[model samples]
Target chain A: MCQLLGMNCATPTDINFSFRGFSQRAGITSDHSDGFGIAFFEDKACRLFVDNQSAVESPIADFIRDYPIKSRNVIAHIRKATQGKINLENSHPFVRELWGRQWIFAHNGDLHQFNPTLTGRFQPVGDTDSELAFCYLLDQLAQRFRQGHPTLQQIFDVLKEIAPKIAEHGTFNFFLSNGQALFSYATTKLHWIVREYPFKHARLIDLDMDIDFSTVTTSEDRVAVITTEPLTNNEIWQAFAPGEMILFKDGKILQQVLTTVQRLEMEKKDPSLVRKTKADPD
Target chain B: MCQLLGMNCATPTDINFSFRGFSQRAGITSDHSDGFGIAFFEDKACRLFVDNQSAVESPIADFIRDYPIKSRNVIAHIRKATQGKINLENSHPFVRELWGRQWIFAHNGDLHQFNPTLTGRFQPVGDTDSELAFCYLLDQLAQRFRQGHPTLQQIFDVLKEIAPKIAEHGTFNFFLSNGQALFSYATTKLHWIVREYPFKHARLIDLDMDIDFSTVTTSEDRVAVITTEPLTNNEIWQAFAPGEMILFKDGKILQQVLTTVQRLEMEKKDPSLVRKTKADPD
Candidate 1:
């Protein structure tokens, strides 16, 4: 078991506030104290900081908390090391370059017997099922789109086809980002919240701390935060159904999909349950 | 021009002393301060830290100085940004994964009109001639060895063929490592030194600091350092002849080669100019 955190913002935004609470789960409030990693995307490039040390005690994490790095998309993970040795190579979030864009991935749940045939284009340096799953996803993407770079929608479609298949093995809550957008799928536990205009004060559930978002943010600033567990107690966090995938871009949900199993179950209850939502026009 | 620093060690060693003086070149000692990055390799994977902020003022750099991260192979760069915009993406050293091993590269000199045909396998995230050259080299390697992973000697042979061609355009002094070994090539300026048993005191050229390596290191520890300019004032630093390439592994030179131009120049003076060296057995 691990924890995941992701942020998609309309503007370049820092994750210090959310990360402070999320990292506490690594050692203080929770027992995910194996290793931790975080990636902050600056356009197509990202600065990935990872450590085999627990985030609560890592000097890098301390620097991250002290320094504010703003990014449009960010992904972070704290590991419990279900598989793979606890080392720098096994630390999450794992990063790989695909289609000239840096892709970051982190997983929160374990997968059993999840080895997939790899074409060697994208290979995992670490021996974790999480990294293996990530590499498999990238390998499939590279094979599917052999020509030019795929658009966000095209990638989302491919992921929609692939996530459920990977989830079938076991719990498969994960976050994937390519600087432009963030895609998250949950098979077991995941939650997300959107903070936009008229932002009010929020308090951390793990620590005795609070933030007045309205004081620090402009009205145009919008941010979407996804995590295995809600970081704040005051903010309303929406839980993802057993099989749901969401694509977030510019701090808003661009598209959402349900797994075939969930869709079938929903149709059995009500035909309106299989609903599709379009992106809001900016 | 920028500054480059690299370390290859027989044992995992901390680079605090070298990095302290090397980082000073970013602002205090010299003005290659547009941005900076460093990569510390842990087996086939690495921890890459990059910042658009000058190393002299960057908090990340401060943290690096305060904390010692031990690695067997390390590559670092301080960018002056003659080719690309002064941003995070343009900062060196650049990293890309090939054959499941992370390759780290950093360049000190500028390349003029040096765009090479990319096969879409490895592409530069930023618009830098250095990164373009790196991508070009990886593309060439991927094309040459499509079947399996190439040996260190094979990669060295390929680099000998590719480095001279890229240097024809402009200065191409660079450092590259894949955790197994460190490869360096020089067009204009580069230097290296090896510290082993009977290690003596060395003083930094940039800062008024000195270290007695014999007191801190064991006899089994051997370290080879490569830099744009020698960091120490007392150590004997060997200058790389123009168009010279050297491969270092386990803190010792494994092989060395001179470009045809340099070989011809040396042969004109002495017939025994073309020489080859083999790795020393432990």
Candidate 2:
């Protein structure tokens, strides 16, 4: 089991500062400490760094602390391995490529007997269930849309159709991206939030640090962050329901499709669709 | 410090199978069991799964054992603590938004008193040096290119310049992507390899599994995987020297740059540079 952190913004931003405080939980200030790694995005690409030597003691991990490569999107991981061996090759935030774009990914779950035939243009380079899952998904997309890639809406339908098949096998919460948009899904625990106009001060849950968003962003800029757990102690992070998928673009959700079970759940609490009319309804 | 795994393809792939065997190193089969998480890409976005619980004992992790969602890209982490408190907020594979694209990151090192100010534009929600660095890098990009966005080349140059500054504080190694390409940098320990056509049969060093990549991939397919250590026992992994950055597209190196010091060091190591002709051209 491990913790995951992610960021997406309307404008470019750096993750070094946040990472500085986040990496401590692994084994130093806390105990998840096994290893850690991070990836930073720059335009249509990203810069990746990883260490198997426990971010607490690794000199390479220390180097990452001072590095300030910025990107519009980024993903990070700290591990506490539960299944596979502790070798360098079995790290988090694995990467692969398909189509003409370079895609990046990371996983935090354990799968049992999850062998699936991967009939596509992509394949796994490692032995983790996470990588095999990545391959299977890409193969499905290719099989589903054997021609030109479909629009996001069309693809969303496909994702909805596919997410369940995989979820049935076991836990299937995850995050994925392709330089244009970010997709988040949860079968059990996942949460996310967006900070846009009128950004406010955010305090870290793992560290006693705060930042006033108003100082760094403009009205035209918006930001979204998703994680397995809330990174801040004082922010409202909406938890993802079981079997829910949300697509994000331009720093906000472009499409969200909850399992019928989730909608039915809301119906149980709110007979009408009006679940939580804000203090001042628009 | 940590390990990372990612996949990006033209089709969907399942990671659960591979992750099943990979998570063992986190304290079960190995000792990394601090925490873990994973993210999967569907289109422009992704679905992330994480567990503060050890991947071996957590019921959620157990469920992941059999799940099989396929994706185009994925990221996973196994922690070994360095900075932030362990509970949940400091978990790796962090996510955020930038320029409307979703991005993900993971880290594997520790830094000393390294914190950067995040403008209102982007602020890290976690408490780790890796996240802070991620945010700071993005803020810089936003400050430098506000009119439109910079090209990949432009961004690459910025990474080269900023990476060293951050490295000054501590070890800096990370993986990042908006989706299109993967950018990787190594200061002390990071290795990667591109797997495309002419694939071969690979076996896992930690688990009992083998796959024939030649049977799954096509000549048009390409993949680049970066990690703190090699995952497979038979794969050829390229080691990154300190102060080096490379851009991966379609699973291959598209461009590469090195710090001035790194270039000089390389020049000194290889006599071929000075001789202009090698005794054995082969």
Candidate 3:
């Protein structure tokens, strides 16, 4: 098991406050102390930092806490080594280049026998099943749009088709981005919160620290945070139901889809569920 | 133009002492301060740190100087932005994965009209002649060895054949590594120094810093450093001739090759240059 943290913002913002609480799971509040990694996207470029040491003790993590690297899209992970050994190659938040842009991915759950064919250029350097899944996703995307780059909506449609299939093997909660939009899928546990105008004070769940958003943020600033578990106690964290996929861009939801599992269950309960809700067409 | 610094060691060693003086060239000493990056190889995995900020001003660089992350192979670069914008995407050393191993590269010279056909999987993320050359080199290497990875000697042979062709376009001084060995090629300025059992105190040329290798290193340890300019003033550095390529593994030279430019120049002086000296067989 691992923990994931992702952020999408309307403007470049630092995640020191959230990361402080999230890193506690590496050794303090929880036991996910195998390794840790983080990726921050600045336009089409990415800055990735990974280490085999626990985030709580790594000097790199300490530097990250002190350096406020501003980015619009960021993904981070603290690993427990469910599949691969504890090494730099097996650290989470892996990055790859696609369509002349950097893509970052991090997973929070384990999969059983989840091997996929890797016939494309994208290949995992590590032995983690999570990395293999990331490579497979990138390969499928590259296969579908072979000519050049695609729009965000087109990517969302393709990901909606593949997320459920990968989730069928076991738990599959993941966050993916390409310096453009953030796509999050939940099979077991995930939560998200949007902070915008009229921001108030918030306290961390793991640490005895608090922040007054009003003092540091402008009214035009908007931020969306997604994580395996809630980082703050006072915020309105919306829990994702099993088999739910959401696309976040510019700190707002652009699209949402119900997985095959959720759709079938909804169909069994109420045959008119389709008519009651306006599902976005793929 | 930019600057390159690389180190290959028989044992895992920290490079803080050498890096301190090398980083001074980013702004304080020479002024190649558009951006900077460094890569440290831990076995097959790599930890790459890149910033659009100058190393002299970047907080990340300050952290790197303080934290001692030991590695066997390392590459560092400070860019002067000859062809690309000063942004994170254009920072070196660039990294890509092939055959389940991470390859790192950094360049120190300009390439003029150096566009090569890129029909393979490798592509340049940033718009620079340096990165394009790197992609072309990797593409040609992949083409020659399609079934699996080749030995270090085999790679050295292929590089000897391709480096001269690229050097024809413009200056092509560069450093490349795949965590196993360090390969350095010079079309212009490059220098190297090896330190072993008979260690002595060395003084930095750019800073008021000194280090006594006898105090920290064991007699069994050996290290080879390759840089655009010598980082220390007291050490005896060997200068590479124009169009010469050297491969360093385990802190020692494994193979050396003369490019077409060097061979032609040597032939002008002595037509029987090949028979006079023993050249390693391909």
Tens-digit lDDT track of model 2 for B1-282: 555665545455566645766676777667667677776654545445555667776544565566566565667777766434553445567666444345677665654445555453445444567766776787787788766457778888888898777666557777666566666777787777667778788777667878888887777666666677766788887889887888766566778988742222332343332322211000
lDDT of 3 by residue, A153-266 (tens): 999999999989877656789999999999999999999999998989999998999999999999878999999999999889999989899999999899988887432232
- In candidate 1, which residue ranges exceed 4 Å CA deviation? A261-282, B261-282
User: Scored by Cα lDDT, where does model 2 land?
Assistant: 0.65
State the lDDT of candidate 1 residue by residue for B61-157, as single tens digits. 8888888998999999887755447887778888888888889999877654455677887887777777878899989999999997899999999
Q: What is the Å distance of residue A42 in model 3 from its true position?
A: 0.8
Q: All models, DockQ values?
A: 0.59, 0.02, 0.47
Which TM-score values does chain B get in all models? 0.91, 0.83, 0.92
CAPRI class assigned to model 3:
acceptable
Pairs of residues at least 3 apart in sequence or in different chains that clash in candidate 3: none
Looking at candidate 1, what is the lDDT of residue A214? 96
- Show the colliding residue pairs in model 1: none
Give a tens-digit lDDT track for model 2, residues A1-282. Answer: 776777777787766656766777777666656667676655544455665667777665676676565567777877777655554445566654334244567666554445567542344433567666776776676677655456768767877887676565456676767666777777777789898888788888777778888997789887788787777877799998888898888789889988632222322433342322211000
Score candidate 2 by TM-score against the native: 0.47
**Model 2 spans > 4 angstroms off:** A260-282, B1-282
C-alpha TM-scores of all predictions = 0.92, 0.47, 0.91
lDDT-sorted candidate list, best first = 1, 3, 2
